[model samples]
Target: MADKIPQKCPECGGSFTAKKLTTTCPHCGTKTELGIDGNARYAYVAPKPNQGKTFTATDLLNEFSAKHVSGPGMPDLMGVNKILKTVSINDVCPESGMTPLHWAIVNRNRAVFSLCLARGADASKRGTGEYEIAPIELAHREGLTDFVDRLVSHGASADDDMLRPIKEQRQVAAAATRERAAVVKETIARLTKEGKRAWYQEQVKHFEEILGIKSSVARGRGIRAFEKVPVKSLAEKNLGMEEWLIKLHDLAFEGGATLFCEKGLTVSSKIRLLLAPTKSVLDVVAVSNLLSPDEPGCERVDIGRQLEKLYVELPYRILECGRDGVLGDIRAMPDDLEGLAKRLLDICPHYGQTLQAGNGKPWEKVDDVTAVKNDLTESRGFFLTWD
Candidate 1:
């Protein structure tokens, strides 16, 4: 009995009935075999082990194109491997004039691309027609720096024309970094001028990170240089001290000091005021002798004297000093203490004056100008007193 089955001829595209799975197309007289779908349409049969079957370049091209469609899902990589085994990796498709590597690029099939490269695909080869570009140029156009680098490493010609765009991109990025660094520098300067020490320090850190350089202005220690004492804690010790400290806190906030405690208390038990811009500490007395009358080593002055010192004197000498004032420029004293002492005297030339460099340090009489200079140079801080 004849095993008749409907089939289409692969070469002539004619409909016919075949007597067997592997049979000749009666209409075209071409040797045909059943495809996987049981249709004896394809003229070629699957290759047997250890036997090479001849396939036209067009045949290999059509097979690769059909299997490597764009979009998600595993591409038929095994099919491509099989086709490449018979044809050269550089063989061009007659329809698209693109080699196997070019098709892998267009399809964005990384697996196929890697496979082609591993199989000695020429990185310098240019495709014809619409994709008439060398492999390195294509990778560069796609913004694949890794691919371009890899291609160059694999003997692709690194001509100036091929590398110009990458150079231009780097230049643009460098210019942008410089512009941002300039803006940060300006911000840091403005913050310093406004007496905003906490905010200023933050910007200084950011500025250093951007420019990769440590700033000289940032050499002074930060707010941590002052002891942190809460205004409420002081109030607990002396209820009457709270109101006066609150007023001072408000002034400090307006001047840009980073306050550690609620109501801006950064003072120690004996009352140390923070001159934020210079990172200097000033020792001040209580608002009145009544405020801390019994505390040892705490000078209790009359209310009028206290007001004059805290409300009027220190603000003018330290906080409100213009950007180029003596204290503003005195983060650390220069080696020439005599000149620094003269600068100090030029600012406040009052009689019976004394200057203390740090907390618990003995006050140096301003009349002995040399001693004052030495104290200023050593401590990097200043606390002025008058009898």
Candidate 2:
């Protein structure tokens, strides 16, 4: 019987330990002791260690009113206080259909209400009454504005009849919702169209070969412009970099390979299209120093040589972009750019070091193309070494 006996503090009516649980109420300052019948009860005297406390109806009610909120895993007010070792009122007034918040408001126990609020009990759950009334509804029906205000502040929606809608009201609501969606779609479409229009200009050219329109019969500068092959003409004529880039893209697909110079193909407008299936900025450096002033090399070597010149000059620029531990736009660059950079480095004797460094290898000084190419052929006995 002693082992089975529940140990509790009689004063505050909380659970207590065998050693320290034999004590008075810390909260209410009531004395506690065990009677001769070996049951616990509260008394005016200070609680002694051997005596247990017995609780009465008022004591149970006081405990229930004191502990309103569920602690930790408990969901509502009743589950928390009911599990406490001291109070028995939780069993007497166990919630059947109503939430703890509903019970708290219906009882109008402010201490329990405040405790329930502190322990995160939601005030929005409606009571189990006929109307499915929320705590505030009970408060409002019972003339409890303070409790209703408390519920409102704790995220309870003010509109109690919000769930119900008349047929006419629903029709209007649906129409307004659709109107808002339509406006959003229209705004998005308009913005997209405006952005596209701003970025690109559209043009249609007449192709004599495609359409079978004879060049002899063609008229005006427009027709003449359309008649000339883009790469051949651009390589021979003066074009800006941006214009050259556009024409170069048009030509790489149109023609396999073409070489241009500062003299014949104006320097500012020279875009070299490195690949056909993809767009990549392999490298673009116009070396006026390397180009022969008196004589031009054969087309193949000239193109290769121009590419080599770009390889030598562009490494420092790439390094600068990568210096802050980010390649920035280059890191997010298209796959084509990565491929083109690789191929361009592969063919150039001076570019091996650049490729290795780009791939996270330690940096080493790769001498300029003119010296490296000589060393490869002279000492290494390699015909086309990358570095």
Candidate 3:
């Protein structure tokens, strides 16, 4: 005996496992299981891969009646031909505010326009009133003479005097562009001149600070030295006082030292508990401190010792000046001051306080009290005479 094949119930498209199946679908309770000699029914079959690819002209006609517009390309043309078989051209795109006649006329497609007119498209079907200006106006502006001719032949108004002087309007636009360019050029020239003047003034000030001289002489010297010094040389390393202060007042700005004095000290008789630094004392301390460094094998040991010795000896000279209630005025020894300021800027850059070029029209970054005081006095344009 052979094993039996399972029967598929037609109602639910499901297989029945038993060899002798009942007449009803077990899942749906429909009479799908037929007896052996009952009425014959065909089995379900899947379609071929390209079975639904093509459309008939009647299909295109129905679709166009339903949808007002069709896209471009081979597939769209196939569908368009299908709709054309069943419907007239005028009835196809009525809802779109354009008939096939209007589309063919506007696009200057003479063959398409002929086909549409042969298919009973009305020549005088005007589009909806939503357009501010009609389609013919657009064709005129774009200089599409072919489309203009087609519209005129289709009974569109050719004598409409709605044209603007487009050439004159374009010339005016070109003139406006030239004016804007000139304004930009003027602004750029103005900025350049302003920058040059500001830089010149700053250089003049820098020279006076170094040479302890009048601005007029220093200004001329600064201009000459500015040309001589290479920008790379200035940036390579920190400046030393001898290289800075030894120049003539007409020389470019360089470096120097600060000569401290007793009057510059914060401590008094009542506040003697606090350390009061006099020029001579400070010089001795600087030399001694450099000679005895906390770190061993430090770089530039020999040069460091020499600088320390110079720092110690110079304070004594300033002490004499301090006796007259004046710390050697910074302006009097511009080169020395520049070197001192540079050195101080190198190490205790903030002089034990936070470094800030404070907010204002003119900016300054001096954390050391004495340096800050001198800067203020110099800025005031008065001889900083100590009482």
Candidate 4:
């Protein structure tokens, strides 16, 4: 017969006899153990490591929360892996129905979230209750574009519904930028016309800063009038070219000063003629200086020679306008030509017609012609010469 020892239940403090190394308390179902000695006292028995133990979703959440709070960067990855072994990565907490991924997002813990993703957490799984949305949706709602991108790379659906908000936001921002640019132009024009030279210079610097354009002032001989270069008769001319010449003449009467000219089809001469009244020559010098020997247009040994081959070409390119010595009316044009073509057509439909009737291909077919047309229409001025 087995020896029976008198013992007390460690959990409930109930008297009992321990007939085996491990015995259960009949009173409270608590397990107790006794030594081989007949006089050995009963003690609470801890189950074997991981024996009959189930790691629930709640346990995983608590572990992650504790680690997230205690650590600086990420939760203890080993601890997370241990719990993940027993608990499904997609398991939802009983109370919140939020998976570990959802919890990571809630805590804004990207490290843990990425770990969960790497461990096969379902990014497409929608949680219950307040977070009844997929991980990507939550990421998007939180304005985590990188997170959304990652989720997409990991196979999360980038449906139109999920991306519409970002597209809409970008459109709104672009519209605001355009509006703000217009306001800046108007203020600069007003300041220039009011003879507020000090304010105008400040505004011009501000405009240059906003547009990411370098500030340059024409520094050569300042001629009060521009010499009219006679061109082919209208019948033999590209009407677009004729219109541009007409616009330059108009700008001359409106406070523009001819700075210099290089009278030829050379790049420097063309840039000079096109930006004649404006102050973008310094821009040319700056661009020429920035060029490297390996660059395409920098093959010419001299900086001045290189400036002639630099990006600006015949007819397509036009002067960039700003407050510094640019015509007051011209200063009202936006620094960039993006979407300006439509605005130009809205303001001056006849200009588009003239570009279409020009000797060259229609503006739409030409790469930069629409941009030039837009600039000319907005400033009611022209500085570019056609080849």
The TM-score leader among the candidates is 4
Any runs in candidate 4 off by more than 4 Å, and if so which? 1-52, 68-73, 164-387
- What does candidate 2 score on TM? 0.23
Worst 10 residues of 2 by lDDT: 319-328
For residues 128-209, what per-residue lDDT tens digits would candidate 4 score against the true structure?
9988989898888887765776787788998886677656655765665555444334433432344334543454444344
Better of 3 and 4 by lDDT: 4
- For candidate 1, write residues 149-251 as lDDT tens digits: 5677678887786567656755765565555444334434544565454565664454335333454432222222223333334454544443444444444
Better model by TM-score: candidate 1 vs candidate 2: 1
- Per-residue lDDT over 63-82 for candidate 2, one digit per residue giving the tens place of the 0 to 100 score: 44331112111123343344
Off by over 4 Å in 1: 1-53, 56-77, 164-387
For all candidates in order, the CA lDDT equals 0.47, 0.36, 0.35, 0.48
| lDDT (C-alpha) at residue 83 in model 2 | 41
Q: lDDT tens digits, residues 15-115, model 3?
A: 55433333444566544323343321122122112225543333432333221112111123444555455545654333345555555545555446556
